[model samples]
Target: MNSIQMDSDPIAVLMQEHHRAAKQLSLLEQAVISINVDGFTRHAFECIAEAIRFFEGEFRQHDKKEEQFLFPLLEKHQPGITREYRNEHRELWSAFNHLLSCVNDVEDGRLRGSSRQELVETATRIVHLLRAHIANENTILFVKAKKLFSTEEYKEFRDNVASVTA
Candidate 1:
């Protein structure tokens, strides 16, 4: 069975979410690495469809939290580093959209053979980019931003995110 680690720290919890998303993305990569999207049916189709839905829906909302809540908090506190941080987030956002498009292509019967290869490559690139983004955000950005927010500020963010996502 699959189990997740429990962490009460708000930032830690969000980082864990990132880890879970990355794991799901990795599973999709492995799924595609060994099969053709159009060729796979039955169980494989279900699995890939679930993965795509999670990435397309859940992860997209998660990105909203970063863009609306987290990044703004960090940018307010650390103007000097905002450029690099925003740049990375922007690129990752674009890559995620591209990955979504590739999955859409597969779902719509446009992906076959080498087209499947392109889809897999696009997904893999998103996974790599997000993994890197999560690492940096957890190690540096989140930690620093936590310092900037008062307990009140942090609590506001925490409550709003939980309410929307729940």
Candidate 2:
């Protein structure tokens, strides 16, 4: 079973999501590296496709949970604390869109030869951006949330996240 499913604590569950994101990003990294070395193999294509699916679905949901539930509460506790994180979310979404377009171009046979670099660059951007964002959330935002949130607030967050993720 996934740690996200096992953990009742909302912060812990979010951390689990971060772990999953890290794994996916690692796959993307490996795929790009393989493309660079061996050219576009089926394995690389499958990895990139899997990454696209993940970012389109679970990644968006995770961000939505933070934006909707977590951010508001954090902002209430400390005004403007979440501003940078919100901005990063916007940036990540933009990169995700770019990556999607690049992947689509490859899938549709729109780009050849150059598609490798395009895919590598775009995936690198998203992977780096998201990894930094997750690091900040795990190290800073989530730490503050744990310290500042009341038990009731924590419960509400857990319940809200569970409802959405379920």
* Candidate 2 clash pair list: none
Report the Cα lDDT for residue 83, model 2: 94
Off by over 4 Å in 1: 1-8, 36-44, 111-113
lDDT of 1 by residue, 1-166 (tens): 0122223545765786788787777777667665664455555555566677886777777777776777776666766665676687778678767766766776787866676667667667777777787788878878777778777667766765676567
Pairs in steric clash, model 1: none
Q: How accurate is candidate 2 locally (lDDT)?
A: 0.87
Q: Of the candidates shown, which would achieve the greatest lDDT relative to the real structure?
A: 2
- Write down the TM-score of every candidate: 0.75, 0.91
Best by TM-score: 2
- CA lDDT scores, all candidates in order: 0.69, 0.87
